[model samples]
Target chain A: MSTIDPTGHPNVHQTAAELATGDKTDTLLQTDGLRKDFGGFTATDEVDFSVDAGELRCLIGPNGAGKSTLLKLVIGTYAPSAGSIYYNGRDITDLAPHRRVRRGISMKFQVPSVYGELTVRENARLPIQRFADGEERRRRVDDAIAAAGLTGYEDVAASVLSHGQQQQLEIGMAAALEPDLLLLDEPVAGLDVAEREAIAERIVRLNEEEDIAFVVIEHDTDFVASIADEVTVLHNGDVFREGPVEEIKADPDVQRIYLGDEQ
Target chain B: MVANTTDGAGSADAGGPMDALRRRIEGPNTVGNSRGFWIGFTVAVASLVAYPLAVGSYQASRFSLFLVYAFLGLSLSVVWGYAGVLSFGQVVFFGIAGYTFGIVSVNFATPLGITAAFLLGVMGSALVAAVLGYFMFYGGVRDVYVTIITLVSTLVLHTFMAQTAGDEWTIGTAALGGFNGMPTIPTLALGVGGAAFTFDSVTFYYFVLALLIATYLGLRAVVNSDYGRVMVAVREDEDRTRMFGYDVKRTKLAVFTLGGALAGLSGVLYASWGNYVSPQVFELAFASLPVIWVSVGGRKTLLGAVVATVGIEFVRNSLGGEWAFIAVGSLLLVFVLGLPGGIVPWIHRAYVDARGDATASNPPEAETVEVSD
Candidate 1:
């Protein structure tokens, strides 16, 4: 697993093994039979999910397909009604949100949720200060801002930034934590083509440079194609299909259920 | 993965509703540069130092009582303004301190006993706040419901304290005095028999003033620290802060307990200065007053709370208690409707605006480089 290449090379048999009982060193996050129900309605059904270290994965699903619910479950915002989640092979199904964060899992919400009352630097500094102090904290904050391409805007308040800038700031805050797995929900949901492309590039660069894994939820297939090494299609609270982007795109079921049956 | 994109150059500016509030609470920009702040500081210090000397002894004691009341205002500012926990039962802390001080001082009647009473009152209030706050915060009670719980708690405590006026209510030698209240309480003093220095003179007035100043500066420092920033962050968004790896419940509880301890300190001072302790401290009407003082002064700003408490208490004193209640109600309504940020924030904004105008008329030298080679 350590010798396995991360260059998106196709190794069909190896991919299958990685999914079942992921290599402990390579798997950053995994969920087994994860289930969540609100009353009689099941928001997430029996689902097994996994993300390898340093791999950029995209989640695509139609509305009510449980993309958001699954993210919530993995991030520990909502405890699973049944089943368990593991981070780096350790059971984390019952951990509280903050404890999960301390264990090197961080998330950006669907909305641009940076600390609006704080300056860009301060917003990023809050999480970085959790593990570091003094000069180390300051350097990490600077690096995170620069990684998000927000170096010049660090002194400004988060609220004044444009929608795209606000989104980047939230990403910067998550980066400051230096997490193993970063979950992004609709990271570029409301942005112009330029802004979306800029954010998409930043995510890819961060994945490559920092060697951090990302589980991104996005509706834009074109954007997903640009960055995702693997794509998982969620439908009706379960994994409908999962594979490399090209393979999933070419699959008949994915086209019929998700790609509008046109392809 | 394949991607190539670049960020567009844009100005970095932000002042959301809470950012302005953050500025008010932290005073990050206003204190150092604003001329009005220095002027106000000077006037406040000079007046505090001189007021007792100029006034009659009886009137001086009343001024000291106001200083003590300011402590409650500061506590509410911390809990409600900074931490965003609206507590209606702040007076309970004050009452606890008042009763504790009265009991300890009356029974023990020594310098060590007096010091111990202060510590116990504060710690006792903190313990109570921690337990109550744990239930409210950890049990998922939030926002207006937290307010409701605190308000209801205040009423229950007031009723329970009123009932303590019966003959069996004596704790140690100190009587619970029912609604009539504890009277002729021993004034705060040092030394034992002959040389004991009592604070019954104008010296007590200065003592409370000094304490108020120290508490004000201490609280300002706390809210401005990294811990304080996170406290404000939690207030702004609990889930977001938690996502960043902070124990939101624990943070809220810490601030709640700190506020309670501050209120407790003020309560003891009130009992010491006025030489009285009573169920009147926990009356529902009085219970609601701290919120008004903090709201009118500036919810998140300590100095604003102190100024508002003293100013409003002054008005209440001169206008007589009943009429003062009516006046406070009217002022609260006006403040809530027109000046939601409170007086200090309004002043800060006016200062910023005025400074903006001056800078705009004469733009500063180009601060940003056109291009980096």
Candidate 2:
């Protein structure tokens, strides 16, 4: 039931249920001189970045600073005009979006990503059922829903969930694939302070327990400070700063442009 | 609500194929499935079988044409309503298949010929859809553009077919017909020579009705299956689905091609019924008619599509001329505005509400959704 093969790339399928989890030193995802230009406008201009296996990283940027664009680039939503993306030690720059997903890369959108009309179980089942079949699929779906802290809400329609719960459902759906890496775009954008804390806690718990590497694109400094072990700051389509979370938070340029402005 | 789909435990693992099929037919993926829904379905099907007993031979024959259109309606309902890919010109496939069946069956005029023609017509339309779907999806033609491209395809076919009036436009014994249309084509049949079983009006009505029932149940099960979940996912959000590891273009292509085959099946019936084929079938009015049928019936529900197609066409035939247009146009407005889920789902909500939500009766994690959206 392996939908993708990370070893050879290009949707070479093999049973991957027992896929070896790489050590933490392994760079799960990296971009080398990745550049994206929309007609004449460059959204992410030749930025190099990398994340280790099981790392929890946050990307912070001001408006038009390419945080979202970089995430899209990594997920194969946007093809870079120049440069390449490497995943699991293989060059995956030309891989299709679905192929990338099969290679254990999943992304949750900035928007309300839940299939609002589908029930929580249906939403959860879509990703798990893609690769896992029958009883195993059902088991994983139940596990993922419960893992997202939404076990009892399985029968409820996703649309009626509070804004924060909806986000958790989307994350749950994203995690149902058991992806090695998950990219989240503005996962806490529309939530309240308490709601944001709930989401942040969920993200961190998933990161440690599942050993799933995460690169969350957010503009919230306090949120990032709480959850992310490492942080990357972007400005004008380039990596403006990258370091351990606290050091990056203390970076003057980042505070002046993003954190200071937010305050 | 696509809600009860998660509770796979209810189907009882030790069922036979017939029981499995029954489970699929009565599955929670579709809008219907209450005990009341099945009872109504049995009653409705029984009535359809006995319909000719009440009406004259002419009315029965006329109603068969409406049954033919239900295939078209179901085609659109799956593609547009369930899959969320609104197609404005499903009838183009109908025309394509009708012409193919008319041409092949006319030249051979035998049971084997009709059988071959049926296969050719369905496969031919599906092939066209596959090719067109490939370009539209893979080339990044999305949303309204896909709708526009389909509409343009129908218009192109119409303009081209309408001009094939000359002697050079004949395919063997069959003429391309141009605007004049092909007539005197053989009716549908099966088996070879001495054993050939041909259909008259009453037989054909029963035959297509049986076919419709099988198709409906089969499709309900398909949508409730794992693949159906992906189809719904693709419909809900293309990009998000892609991120979930589905090659969405392939899913869209497959659905579009299936839809084409369904519309093509209707076309084969249409040609067999009338013994005629015309470029007028590809005209904008015919092209846009299925959209209205599915929309007014309930785009999301198969029952809605079939019922709406037959009921609306009957109403149109009875009302006649400008009055029919006014009535259909008015009905469409009412459903599109007031009851966007369409008549069947709307009625379904009332029934479910009256019965008190199905999940409310369940023992655990009971949640009721008022499905207004």
TM-score of each: 0.88, 0.91
Question: What digit string (tens of lDDT, one per residue) describes model 1 on residues B146-216?
Answer: 88898888778777877887679987888878877887667877565666677875888887888887787
Name the TM-score of candidate 2.
Answer: 0.91
List, residue by residue over B211-282, the lDDT tens digit for candidate 2.
Answer: 999998888888887788788888889999999899998999899999999999999999999999898998
User: Over the stretch A160-237, how does candidate 1's per-residue lDDT look in tens digits?
Assistant: 667787788888788778788899999998788998999999899889988878999998888999999799999889
Instruction: Give the Cα-based TM-score of candidate 1 against the true structure.
Output: 0.88
Q: In candidate 1, residue B106 scores what lDDT?
A: 81
Instruction: Give the Cα lDDT of each candidate.
Output: 0.80, 0.83
Candidate 1 lDDT score at position B176: 79
lDDT of 1 at A138: 72
Residue ranges of candidate 2 with Cα displaced over 4 Å: A1-25, A259-263, B1-18, B358-373
True contacts kept of each: 0.42, 0.55
RMSD, one per candidate, in order: 8.7, 5.0
On lDDT, the leading prediction is 2
Model 2 DockQ (Cα-based): 0.43
What are the per-candidate TM-scores when only chain A is compared?
0.87, 0.86
